[model samples]
Target chain A: MRRLNQLCCALGLFALSAMAYAGPPVEGALEKQATNWHAIIMFCIFVALSMGITYWASSRTKSTSDFYTAGGGITGMQNGLAIAGDYMSAATLLGLTALVYGQGFDGYLYMLSFFAGWPIILFMMAERLRNLGRFTFADITSFRLDQGSVRTMAAISSLTVVCFYLIAQMVGAGQLIKLLFGLDYNIAIVGVGILMMVYVTFGGMVATTWVQIIKACMLLTGGTLAMLLAFSQFGFSFHTLMEKATAVHKLGIKLMTPGSLLADPVNAISLGLGLMFGTAGLPHILMRFFTVGDAKEARKSVLYASGIVAYFFNVIFLMGLCAILVVGTNPDFFEGGTIGGKLIGGGNMVAMHLAKAVGGDMLLGFMAAVAFATILAVVSGLALAGASAISHDLYARVIKKGKATEAAEIRVSRIATIGLGIVAILLGIAFEKQNVAFMVGLAFGVAAAGNFPVLIMSMYWKGLTTRGAIVGGYGGLLSSVAFVVLSKAVWVDVLGNKAAIFPYSQPALFAMPIAFLLIYIFSKSDSSARAKAEIEAFEDQYVRAQTGFGASTASSH
Target chain B: MSSAMYERMRGNPKFQELVATRGRFAWTLSIIVLVLFYGFVMAVAFIPGTLGQPVSEGAMLTVGVAVELFLFIFFWALSALYVKRANGKFDALTAEVIKQAQKGGK
Candidate 1:
C-alpha cells in the first residue's frame, strides 16, 4: 500500500517539473513532419480515457468547495499523484534528455535545481498553507490583510504568471504536436484549448486532479519501459553505460561534470534561488495543498511528492545517459543519415528516438501519446488555477465583498475558465513562431519575487500590514519584470541586442531582497489603526496555522 | 476563531510545546536542505574538475554522479523522517491542544 500510494504521487510531480525546462533552443527546431499513425491512435485512446474521467467527475462537482478543491476529501496518496502530475511536463522529459544528450551532467544539474524547490515547500510551507487556505492562495494572503487590496494584488500577479505560462505551454503543445503527431499547428492549439476548457468548466478540481493522475501513470510507465529496455542492453551496468556514452559523445568526458552552462557563480546561485522559492509561490502548485483533508494529509502528500520528484529526476537522468549510447551512434535517427546531424524532429525528440530504438514502433507510439497527454494535463491545471484567481479572488472577494453565493462564484469560475481558454488559444497562435521559452522563466520570476515574498511574510511574520504587502508585492513584480527584460535572455538572446543590461539571467536573487525590504520597511512604519488590528489578528492566524483550528474542513456533502 | 479561544490556546501548555517543537524541527530541516543544496551548487559552479574526476582510480562513475545519487536518496529520506515524526508525535499533541482549548471554550 505504501509503495503503491507513493508511486502514484511520484509520477505526478515528475511530470510537472518537466515543463520548467522546455527551452527555446529545443522547441525552436520543430518542423512539420509526417504523421505517425501509431502515435495518433495511442493519443486518441488517452483522450477518450481522460474525457471519460471528466464525465465521471462532473457529477461530483456541485458546490464552490467541490469546484476548487474536490471538497478537500482527497487522500494524501491520491493528492500526491494528482499534484505531482501538475509538476511533470513534456518539456521536462524532452528538454532534460536533450540537455543530457548534448551537454551531459549539466542536464542533471538542471534537474537537480528543479527538484530542490520541492523539499523546502514540504518542510516549511505545506501545513501552514493547507491550514490557512481554502479555494485559492489568495485566501491565505488576504486572511489578515484587507482582502480588497491584498487579494487584488495576488490575483493580478497570479493572472500575469498564468497568462505567460499558458502561452508558453500552448505554443509548446502546438509545435510538439505538429512535429511528433503530424498534426497541424492551429488544430493542435485549438484542440488543447477546447479540451482544457471542457475539463475545467465541468469537472472542476476533481476532473483536473484525476486527469493529472492518469497522465502521471502513463508517463511513468512509458518512461520506465524505455529506461529499463535501454539499460538492459548495457548488461545492467551503470559503468558500461557511462563508458560507452562518453566514448561516442562529442562532449566525451567533459559531460561527466558541470560545465559552462552554469559556470558563472552569480547566475548559478540566482537561478537556484529562483526555482526554489518560485515553486512555493506558484498558484497552481499551492492549490494542491488544499486538496487533501488537513495539515496531516498535507504533510504526507509532500513526503510522497518529494520522493517521487527526486526518484524521477534519476529516471530522466539515466534515460538521457542511455540515449547517448543507443541513439547517438545510429545514423538512421538523425537527419540526412548523419550520426551528429540535427535530430529528425529536433533535439527534443531524443527520448522519442530512444524509445523507437529500444522498444520498436509500439513503445514509440505509447511515448508519443504520453507526451501529448502530459501537455493537456498541465494546461488544465493551469487553467483551473487561473480561473480560481479570477472567480474566487478577483470576482467573489473583491467585487462581491464576501457576499457572493456559492453558486454565483462557481458560475463565474466556469466562465473565467472559458475566457482563459480562448485567450490562450489566440496567444498560442499569435506566438507560434516566436521563442516563448522565457515565458516560463518569467513566470517563475514573478512567482518568486511577487507572490513568494509576501506569502512567506504573511504566514511567518506578525507585523505584515496591508500597505506593506501591496507596495512590496507590486515592487517585487515590477522589478522582477524589469530585471528579466534587461537580462541576457531577453535583452540579448530574444531582443538581439549587443549586450544585456542586467548581468544575471535570473532576477530572483536581486528582486526577492527588494521585495522583502520594501515589505519590512513599509510594515514597520505603518502606525494606522488598521495596521495595529492586523498585527493583533496575527495571534489567531498563528493558532489556526499551527493547529488547523477553525480552518476549512472536508465537506460532508 | 474568537479571542477567548485564542487566549485559551495561548495559555495551553501543550499548544505552546507543539509550536516550539514543530517550528524548530521545520527550520532545522530547512537549514539542512539549504546548506546541502547550496554546497552542491557552489561545487558545480567553482570546482567542476573535482567532480569531473573519477570516484577512484579507473572507475567509470564520476564523483559528481556518485554524490548526486547519494543526495537523491538522502533528501527523500529526510522528507520521510519529517513526515514520520510530524504525523505521529506533533499531530497527537495538536489534537490534545485543540481538545483542551475547546473544553475551555464550552
Candidate 2:
C-alpha cells in the first residue's frame, strides 16, 4: 500500500511540474526546465533518516523524564544544534529568502536583528533559565508565585504562541508538500500533521531534539553550498553583482538599499522588538535548555547555537540575494510562469523558485525537501511544547497535585501531542491561503509580553508573588492576542477585510510595557511573604542545577 | 576559608577555565561578528560600485557565490574550533571535577 501510494505521488508531481511549465513565463526569467529527480530523492532520504532517528530516540524513552528531556543527557554541542534547528524554522529559511529575493537589503536587516536575538539569549537568559525550570517555562516562573495562577497563565501563553505560530508552519507544510510531492493541499496538511504527532507522541523531547539537530545540520550545509555556488556565479565580486542586480531589478535593488526600504517605521520597530525579546520567552526554545546536563552545559549549548545560527542566517541572506538575481532572469521559474502566481505574493516562495532557477531541477528539489523538513521539525517541536504544558503543567501539577506517576504522565503527554497535532493541522488549513508571516511575529510578541516578565522576575526577583506572576503573564498574553487580532495586518492582510480597531498595526509598544508594569506593581504589593519563599526556592534550585545534584526542583506537568 | 579555596580550585579548574575561555571568546566573537555583519551592511549603503567591469552577469554572479561560500566555511571552522577546545580541554577538566566531587566511596 505504501509503495503504491508513493508511485501515485510520483506521477502526480510530474503532472504538476509539466503544468507549471506550460504556463506563461514570469517576466525576466529563464524558460528551460526539467523534472528534478535528484532533488526529490534527496528530500525523501532526509525525511527517512529523520524518522529513523526519532524511532531510535523514542525506543529508549521509557519514563516521563526520558521522553520529556532525554534524562538531560544530551551533550552541549548536540543541544546547540538542536536549539539552532528549533529556532531556524521554515519561516526563517524560505520566507526570509523570498523576502530578500523580492525586497533586497531590507531583507538583510531582518536577518541581522533575528541573529542578534541569539547572543541575547545566550548571554542573558540561558543559564538562568536552566537553573530555574525543568520541562516547561512555568517551572521557573511559578516557583515564587502561586502555582495555579502561574500554570494557568503559562498555559494561555503557550497555547497562544503555539496556535499563532502553528498557522505559518502548517501552511508552509501544505504549500511545500503540494509543491514537492504534488499532493492535494488537504491531504498534505493531514499527512504532515499525522507525521508530526507520531514524531512527538512516541519519541517526546528526545525525538524532537534529534530531529531538530539533523535538520539544522542539513539546512546549514544546504544553505552554505547554495551561497557558495551563487557567489561563484558572480565571480566573487559583490560590487559587480550588486550593481548588476540593481541595474536589472531597480525596485528590488532599492529595497535592498538601506534607509528607505521599510514601508512603515512602526512595523519595523514592532518586528525588531518581537525578535529581540521573544527569543527568551519561547517555550519550545527554552525547553531545549533543560535537556543539557547542567547550567554550565546550558550556557555552552547556547554559545554553540549562536555560532551555528549566526552562520546559517548569514548564508541564508546570501541565498536570498542569489535567488532574486537568478529568478529575476528566469521567466519560467515559478508555477504558471508568473512571479506573483508562483510566489503567493510574498517573500516565502522566493528561495525555492531561486533554487530551481540557479541549480536547476536537482537543487530546487533539494531546497523544497529541506523546506518541508523544516516545517515537520518545527511543527513537532511546537506540538511537543504545547503537549508538555497541558499534560505536565495543567493535568499533573494542577489537577493531580504532582501525584501522577511517570508512566501516567508520559501517556498523557503522548495523547496531548496527538491532540495538538490535530489542532495545528486545522489551523494550518484555515490560514493556508493567507500571508501569515505576521503569525510568527504575533507568537513572538505574545511570548515577550506574557512570559518574559514573569520568567525574569521568578528567577532574579524574590518579591514576585503568585498573584503578580499570574496577572502579569495572563495579562500580557491576552492583550497581545487581542492587539494582534485587531491589528491592520491581521484584519486586512490575513482576514482580507479592513477594520480600524487600533491605529497602530503592531502592539509591542503598548503590550510589553504593560506586562512589565503589572509584574512590578503586583510583586511590590505582596513583596514581604513572596520575597522570603522565593529566595529560598531560587537558591535551592540554583545550587541543585549548578552542581548537577538532586532531582530537578523544576516540576514537569 | 582553606576548604573553600581548595574546593574552588579542585572542583573544576578545567570547567572554570572553559567557562572563562568561552566568556572571553563570546565577547570577541560578538564584536567581530557585529563588525563583519553590520560592516557589510554599512559598506553596501555607503560604498559605490566600481562600474565598467568585463565580467558577464553570470560570471559576476559566480564570483559572488564563491565569496558567500568562503564565508560559510569560515563560520564552520569557527564552530569546529570551539568544539575542539571543549572536547580536548574542557571536557577533560569537567570529568576530573566530577570525579573529585564524588561521594566518600570514590
Candidate 3:
C-alpha cells in the first residue's frame, strides 16, 4: 500500500534531497508488489468487526421495514455519520487527492462542486422525503400517481444510477486492492462483491449504517492525522507549505489557481448541475431519510452530514497540498523513480504515499484498511437501495399491487442483493482496463436528469400525472445516458474516436430542462380522468408532506 | 388522514402560514446557494485566474482557496440555520396544525 515500502526504507533519508532518479523496476506497471503485512492485518481486523456486526444484525432483520429502513429507529447523529460514510467513497480520498496532486486548484474546485449538493438536499428534499416515503424514493414519486407505471420508471432510473455508481466503486476497489494487498485484480473484485452482498442480504440497512458510521470515523481520524503530520513539516503555516509546494510542483504558481478541470463553460455548469442535483436523486442517499425517526431527525442528519463532509473536504484539500511537498519530492513514489513521472500505483495512490511519508508505515496501513472499509460500506448501501427498488417498488408495488407479504418482499430483496453483487463483480472485471472516472460523472448525470426532475415535479407540482412522469423520466434517462455516450469522455477518451458528438462532457445542463419541459407539456395536455384524479390526490399528499400527519411512523415493524 | 381533516387543515390560517413561511425560507436558502455557487462557477469560467491571485501581495494563499474555505463554512452554517428554524418553529406549528385539524374533523 505504501508503494515499495522497503525501497523507501533502503533509500533512507536520501529521499529528502528531492532529486530525480530512475525508479527500481521497469517491467510491469500494475504488477503485484510485496504483500503489505501490516495493512493486511489491519484490514482483517476491520473485516472481522464488520462481519460480527452483520451476524448480530441478521437476527433482528425480520420484516421488510427492518431490512430496508432499520425499523426507522436510527437517530439523527448516527444517520448523519452513516450518510457521510456512504457519500465519501474511496474516490473522495484517493481520486480527489490524486487530481489535486496532478491538476491542483481544479481538483479543489471539483470537490467544492460535490460539497455544494448538501445544502440543497437539506433545504429542498430531506424533510419532504422523510414525511412522504417509506422504503424507497419511488414511494414518494408514486404517492399520487399510478403506482405501476411511475414506480416502474423510478425503479429503472434508480437501478441505472446504482449500477453505474457500483461500477465506479468496484473498479476503484479492484485497482486499490491490487496495489495495497498485492492481490490479483479479479480476486479483489470478487471478494468485495461477495462481502457487500453478505452485508445487505443478511443485515440489510442496519448493518450498512453501522459500517458507514465506523468507516466515517476512521476516515476522518486517519485523514486528519495525515494532514496534521504533514503540516508540521512547514511549521503549520499555509504560506510556507504553498511556497515550498509551488517551488517543487511542475505547475509552479499555477497550482494555486483554477486550471484545466473546468475550462468549457457548458461543461463546467453542466458538471456543477450534475453534482449538485444528482445528490438529491441518488437512491442510496435518498433511502437514508427513511432510516430516521421523523422529519426532524432527517433534517438533523443532513445538518450533521453537511458539517462532517465539509470539514473532511478541507482535510482532503490540505492532504493534497501536503502530498505535493511530502510525497511528490520523493522519487520512491514514482513508477520510474522520477519526481514528475507517473505514480507507482497510478496517480490515485498519492494520499497513501503521503500517509507513509508523513505519519510513517503505521498510518499508511490504517488508511489502507479504512479505504477498504469505505468501499465495502458504500457498496452495501448501493446494494440495499438497488434491492429495495427491485423488491419494494417493482415487485411488491407494481407486480403484486402492494399486497405482497412483508416476508416475501424481504426474501426478494435478499435475492436482489446477491444478484446486484454478482453483477458488480462482473462489471468491475470487465471494465478494469477502461477509464472509470466518467462512470461516476455518468451516474450523477443520470441521477440529476433521469431521477431528480421527475422527483421534484412530483413533490411540488400538482399537475404532474403518471403519463407525464413516465415520459419525462424515461426521456431524461435516455438523453442523459445518450449525452454521455456521445460526449468527449466516452466518445473520444474511451472509444478512441476522433471527436465527440456532444461537445460538453456532462448531461445535466441540457437533460434536466428537457425533462422538466416534457413533464410540464404532457401534464398540461392530458385531459384523461386518471390525470384528473391524480391532480385531486395531490391535496392529501401535500398535507402529509408538510405536517407529517399520518406519515409512516418510526419502528413500525 | 380523512378528507374532512384535510379540508379543515387546508382552511386553517396557521396551516397556511406554516406552509408559506417554511416554503419562503427554504426557497430563499436554495436560491442563495444556487446564486452563490453558480456565481463562483461563472467567475471561474469567465475569469479563471482572478481566483488564483494572491489575497495580498507576496502572500502564498490564493483568493480562490480563501473564498472556497469561506463558502464551505458558510454553506454548513446555512444548513444549520435552516434546520434550527424548520425543526423548532415550523415543526411546532405543524404539530399544532395537526391537532387543530383533528379536533375540528372529529
Candidate 4:
C-alpha cells in the first residue's frame, strides 16, 4: 500500500506536468494506446550510438583536462555544431513550436531574443573567455580576485542555474517520453536520469560533445525535411502557406500580428532581458569555450553557432506556421470532433502530430526520437556543468584548497554527477505540474540576474572586489528567486493564491539592475588591501585576456 | 617575462593601437545590436500597433515580421564582418604586438 501510494504520487506529478503544457487532462486514451514501436526502435538506435561514443571517449579521458575540455582537441566547426546542439534543446524545437501554434507572432519574439544572445557572446565574451578560464567559468572570476570566496560564490550560482535548467529538461523529457512511448511518467524520469548519469560520469565532455554534434545534424535534417514537406503541401509558395494558415486559424489575420500573448509591456521586456543575457550566463555554454583550441577558434565557434541557430530558427518559424494550418485545423488531432476542445495528445505535441500529418508515422517516430535525443544531450551537458561546479570549484578548489589530485577530482565529479541526476529526477517529479517552458524562463531569469552581472562586471570592471561579487551574486540570486515565487505566474496560477505581490513573472529587468548597482557600490566603497591589490592587478589580467599570453594550453595527451 | 618587459609592451604604440581599434570595433557592433534590439523591444511595448501594420499595402507580412527577418540577416552579416576583420586585421596587429613584446623580453 505504501509503495502503491508512492507510485500514485509520482504518477500524479507526471500527469500534472504533462497536463500543464499539453492541456486538458485526457489520461485514458494516452494510457490505452500501445507503445510506439517505430519511435522505440529509433530511440534505441540513438541510445546505442551515444553509448558507443561514450565507451570510446572513456578510454581517452585520462586526466582532468580530458574529462573537462575534451583535451581541447575539438575543431572550431565541430565545437560550433556542438554549441548549437547544446542551445537548441527540445524546448526550443517543441515548446516554441507549440507557442507559435497557440500564439502566432508572439513566438517569433522568443526566437529573436534567443538568437540575440549569440551575437552578444561573440562580440563580448567568447575570445576573452577562451583566453582566461580553465576548467570552469569560476576560473575566470578567481583569476585576479580572491580565489576562495569568489569560487565558492560562482560555484553556488552555477549550481543554482544548472539545477533549474536540469529540472526543466527532465520535466520536458518525462512529458515527451510519456507522449511518444506511452511510458509511465516515473519510468521516463528515471530513464532520462540514468542515461544522463552514464554519459557525464564516464564519458564527460568528449562524449557529450560528439553526442551533441550528432544530435544537431539529426535535428537539422529532420527539421528541414519537415519544412520541405510542409512547404510542398502549398506548392512551395510562402504566400499560399500564410494564406492557408490565416484561413484556418480562428484569430485570422491577427495570427500574423504581435501582442496576443505578450500583452503586458513590462513582462515582455523582462522576458526579453532574461533570454538575451541568460545565454551568456549559462555555465554549460561558457564551458564550451574551454573545449576549443584558442580564442580564434572560440570566436569562429560562436560565428558558426549563430549562423546555424539563425537558420534553424527561421525554419522553425515556418514549421510553426505550417503546424497551425496542418495540425491545428485537422479534426483527427482533436480529442473529440469538437474544434475548440483538447488536442489528441496536448498542444506541446503539435510538432510531432504535424510530422505525422506530413510524413506519416515513420517521420513522426523519427522526430520523436530526435526530440528525446535533444533532451538527453542537453541534460548531460547541464549535469556535467553542475558536477564540475561541485567537484572542480567546490571540492577540489575550496575544500582541498587546490591540493586535490586529478584522479580524486574526477572521482568526485563522477559522484557529483550521480548525485545531481538523482536530485534532478526528484525535482522533475516535484515540478511536474509546472509549465516546463515557464520553468526554463525562470531559469534564464536567475542566470541573467545572478551569473551574468558578476561575470560581466568581473571581466570589465576593475573595481570588482571578492566581497562585491559575492554580495551582488547573492543579491541577484535571492531577489530573482524571491520575485519569481512572488510573481503572478507562480503565486496566483501555480500556488492557487488570491493575487501575486510581484506583477511580472520575469525578474531580470529589476533584479539585474539591482545586482549591478550592488556590485558597483560595494566595489567602489571597498578599501581593504586585498581589494586594492585586485584593482592593481586588473591591467595585467586585461592584457592577458586580450593577448592570450600565459593562457592554458591544450595537452598533447 | 619580467615586469619591465610587460611595461614596455604595455607602453608600445602598436599594442595601444591594437587595443584601441579592437575595443572601438567591438563596442560599435555591441551598441548597434543594443539599439536595434532594444528599439524593437520598446516599440513592441509602447506602439505595437505600428509594428502590427503590414509592411506594404495589400501585403500579408506585418512590419514586425519583415523588420525582424531583416534584423536576423543583418546580425549574421555583422558577425561575419567582425570575424573577417578579427581574423585578418586584428590578428595581424596582435601578432605584431606579441612579437615586439617577445623581442623586448629577450
* Best candidate, DockQ: 3
Clashes of 2: 32
Candidate 2 positional error at A33, Å: 11
Where in model 1 is the C-alpha error above 4 Å?
A1-33
**Which candidate model has the greater lDDT, 1 or 4?**
1
Model 2 residue A91 CA deviation (Å) reads: 1.7
Q: Kindly list the per-residue Cα lDDT of model 2 for residues A241-342, writing each as its tens digit.
A: 676776766573343444344335565566556676787888888888889877667867877887887677777777776666677666565456664355
Candidate 3's docking class is: high
Q: What's the true lDDT of residue A274 in model 1? A: 93
User: Native contact fraction of candidate 2?
Assistant: 0.02
**Per-residue lDDT over B19-78 for candidate 3, one digit per residue giving the tens place of the 0 to 100 score:** 999999999999999999999988888887889999999999889888888888899999
lDDT of 4 by residue, A1-557 (tens): 62353335335544543443234323665742234667767877898788778877888887999999999888899999999999999988988888888777888877998898788888888889998898899999888888788899989899998988998899888887877777767778987897888788778999999999999998999999998898799898877887788888877888867764666778777877888899999999999999988888899999999999999998888889998888877888888756757887777888888888999878988998899999999999999999999999999999999999999999999999999999999999988888755567678888899999999888898889988888898899899988988987778888889999998878999999999988998888899999999998888888778777778878886
Per lDDT, what order, best first? Answer: 3, 1, 4, 2
Least well predicted 10-residue stretch by lDDT in candidate 2 chain A: A25-34
Q: Give lDDT tens digits, candidate 3, residues A173-285.
A: 98887777666677779888878887788789989999999999999999999999999998999989999999998999999888877877888999899999999899999
For model 3, the stretches where C-alpha displacement exceeds 4 angstroms are A1-33
Q: After TM-score superposition, what is the CA distance of residue A42 in candidate 2 from its true location, in Å?
A: 3.2
Which candidate leads the pack in lDDT?
Answer: 3
> Alpha-carbon error at A187 in model 4, in Å?
1.0
- Comparing 3 with 4 on lDDT, the higher-scoring candidate is 3
